[model samples]
Target chain A: MNIKIVKTDGDVEGLAEQKWVYSPSVKTHFFHPENLVEDVNGFDDSDYNGVGAVGSPACGDMMKMWIKVDPKSDKVVDCKWQTFGCASAIASTSMLSVMVTENGGMKVDDALALKPQNILERLGGLPPRKVHCSVLGDKALRKAINEYFRHSKQFDRMVIEGSVMVDPDTRITDRDIEEAVLEGADDMDKLQKKLKVGIANKDAYAKAEALMGKFMEKYYG
Target chain B: MKISSQVNKLLKDHKKHDIYLDHAATTPMDPAVKAAMDPYFCDKFGNPSGFYEIGLRAHEALEEARNKVAKILNCSSREIVFCGSGTESDNLAILGVARFKGKGHIITSSIEHHAVLETIERLEKQGFDITILPVDRDGFVNPKDLDDAIREDTILASIMYANNEIGVIEPIKELATVCRNKGVLFHTDACQAGCSLDLDVKELGVDLMTINGSKIYGPKGVGCLYVKAGIRLEPIVYGGGQERGLRSGTENVPGVIGFAKALTLCQDDKDKENKRLTQLRDKLIKGLITKVPKCFLNGHAVKRLPNNVNITILDVEGEAMGLFLNELGIYASTGSACTSKSLDPSHVITALGLPYEAAHGSMRFTLGHCTTPEDIDFVIEVMPKIVEILRKISPLDLDSNEVQEGHGNLHYK
Candidate 1:
């Protein structure tokens, strides 16, 4: 679905969805033209070939990109993203994800070669300081993808069902979503029992539960 | 009345270690001027207004100092009214004129220091109409704009003699001529221009002018306003009759004496010092241009203060540069002390239509009577290194090799 990413000085076309976004100076968001968050949550492991996130609070921009790859064809079937920054940063990340997916699976070398100007031109040119904003998305996308292959052992079933494969080093154990309205847990004891010997250990479960509580409070409360 | 030796040593250490390049902020008092003030603080510390014999002698000395200041400014002693400082002088002039006239229009430039701008703002709230004239790229307000901005109701037109941030000298005499022809009172905040430029009240045709003692290498907390003969201005501060009933306060005898000495000394070496200062200013500007790439001078090249060299270095943050310069014991200012607390650039720079990057990159360097060639050399040598280190770590992409090529192309062009 085509999405319109409106920035302060310009805009770009992309398939919009949430990943992780950051911008120090100003706030922003991502959504598809269908008036809903893109179906990023439904992608299976084979569909999650690569992802990238860039920018820091110190530098004032953050962008995260997710890619779903077709194993048989070695092609990018779908891509989605989220960003937190001024309007330009959000638009750049959204446009970048669409460009990579539309051109098939972006090779590591090709993604690295993408210039800030390319994203800027696509978004109809940003203000001079904001040119740096585009670079963040490019860097994040390449890093997330490279990380997937570098730690492939961690996620042995790279093409699992109903899970987007993040960097191989990054596995979403059941403990990661223990407090997140788990379709399985009945109460606190069940939650704790599942967490104790879960694929992710107790400490990881505790942290993830805390994060889920915060996410619920922030978005649902 | 002498300060403790420990205090003296502390002050001496401050002077020896900190290379103050903010003379436009305030100057270190000259030894001779300080010595001239010694008598007024100690043995002869009598109230000049007292009727005693010692008081009469002190009164006579005070009159002599006034005459000296009056002489340096090319005005009669009767026209000069000593005030607390430059800000007070500005307030007194604007409020006094607006109050005395009862109701009238006022015209001033957009880049005026808050001393004038805030005073005008206060007057505006109190039913006075004010027109803020615009300035050009070089920070020069057109004389024609002043002419057009004037109205039949205009009672006074106030513009600064030189901008504090950019240091661009305005066409004060030209504007004064227009005001004179229109029969409107003219005031100028000559605080920044006091010691650096000549003062001829008659030639400039100004009805009121502000000068700061601190700006002219004298004592702080004392300044004077020049109100031309027969100009009706009411006193803003009311109390015992003083300053020919224009300003009423117990006179600051020592500060006045020091101010007089500073002005007299400045007048004596005006020409030679102006030339010398221009040389140092030029050398500094040239050094920056040759050493630093992607930098542009902010103010007027030819029509600026003899001692001012303000520039904007692209891709480097001003606050970081300020901190790094402080670490090296070299003192300077981003623009004005008023706006230094905020990480933002000077409004004056922004008003000149500079991009945010250029404005945030600005730095002001002002020399003074005590600034030597050695100081300039040291600054020229050390400044680029600091800028280089800052740009390297800055988020703005400013690699030296690309910048060097750009600089080479600029020179070749």
Candidate 2:
């Protein structure tokens, strides 16, 4: 059956039919012949700032989303994937990859708003029962973005050198600021003492302390 | 006359004899069998367990029916244990043997009807190890694999005489021999094979076997489980002392008579009936293969049941085909109706290693003594067009442009 894609941002308008034989396990990704392409390239492996992967073999879908953030701009500059699932699965991942890449500087909030229904409507429409299949890709995209941030924290610890002014003009490396905020604070009282530490160009440090205070009270209190 | 409208509009549109291509599910009651049952329902209805003269007559008639069933199977009447249906008979054979020994392992195939597989699975869950033998592409289980799979812990091996879905007959004699040499109990769910194929319990060397009446144009709700004279089994369903105390149900007198008559009739005309069914089955199989592109037959071409023609058509959903055919007043089924709502294909199809699309498209046409040439002709004429129409509206393809825009309004008067 032919699928005529409708020109809507979030609503897909066509129904496409593919003949798929049922198999025992729904875990592996199946690729159609016409859409097979070479892997995405052009990103430096060392520059890979973050990566996210999610979904489950139990659910019969899995997606590994890769993101490379430019150190200078603090933005996601590149993304790609190797997804394992059905037609809706493959389509959703491919669409999520495009959306994430287009919004290179998108905050996590914008990325999470990528609804599964929007993915379905974009691909025309999925079989009513198969709408749930779209959720795997959308959740995987958000998870990959979260993972990228996690990996970025680790990379900053290893590569970044110094802290900048807290007053908002200076470029403060994520690691240096974090290290300074954590420095000399062995116990809660030391952190509280540092919270009271007054220094020139310390707005960023103070802001960092406030954030850490929120985390500490939420977790340890 | 567009396709979707044609299906959605028409429910029972024709006066042609409703071709029931679902005999593997069950066959219509034969008149002769019903006639035999009539006497028991009227005067011979007294309980066989009673000591009075009328009861004695009922007892005599029950024995006679059992003897007739035994005669058809070439076994002694003492061996037949009557039960509710093919499934219950299967439960008795598999679970009875397993429960008798109280501890041994079992070996079975993946394609066996749930009557065997599900019982074996329950045993597995209860600490009994099970080796599920696999079938070849033709839906035949290899005897060598049975031999190789047998272990010291193995107490019984149960394989179907013929697959209910694909119609492929198993190598029962060979597998039975393997079980015999290993000193293990062998059980064949001969529910499908009983009416169509010759059953010589002595020749096959099976310790236990299962057979059903409804499948052979007998009444539903009654079946037979054959236990060899020497082998002992515990009653899984306990109750009154009946059927030699193995199965305790008050003998379904009418059902027993009908079952015996059906078995006798099958045996009486085995040669002629098989010939007739094979001719129609071959015609249907060959016609569908030649006319339908991308269609793959699902079982052994010649060694299958005489009346089974299972084919997997590419690019069309079997469920949709079933729905479309239903619109045409055609009665056909896609393998198992058990998991139809789940959108997953039959587990039997998956066990055969068929790809997802082909499994989803599988359909079984089981002919019976009642199936006619006209019915075959009607199916052959309408099936291809149905497949074409369903495939045109299928959404599994990536390159299709016709999105099937409207839901309905293309009504046919």
- Tens-digit per-residue lDDT, B184-303, candidate 2: 889999999877888889887788888999898899999899899988888977788799888996889899989999988887888998999999999999889888766768878999
- Candidate 2, chain B, TM-score (2 decimals): 0.92
TM-score of chain A of 2: 0.46
Tens digit of per-residue lDDT, candidate 1, span A113-206? 6755676666666544345445566656656656555444435433232532211222333433443334344433333322221111345445
Candidate 2 is graded, for docking, as incorrect
What local lDDT does model 1 show for residue A53? Answer: 54
Candidate 1 has a DockQ of: 0.02
Two-chain DockQ for model 2: 0.02
lDDT of 1 at A214: 54
Error of 2 at A58 (Å): 14
What's the iRMSD of model 1? Answer: 27.0
**Least accurate 10 contiguous residues by lDDT in model 2 chain B:** B404-413
Chain A fold similarity by TM-score, each prediction: 0.47, 0.46
lDDT of each: 0.67, 0.67
Clash pairs for candidate 1: A21-A83, A21-A84, A22-A62, A22-A84, A23-A84, A23-A85, A47-A68, A76-A105
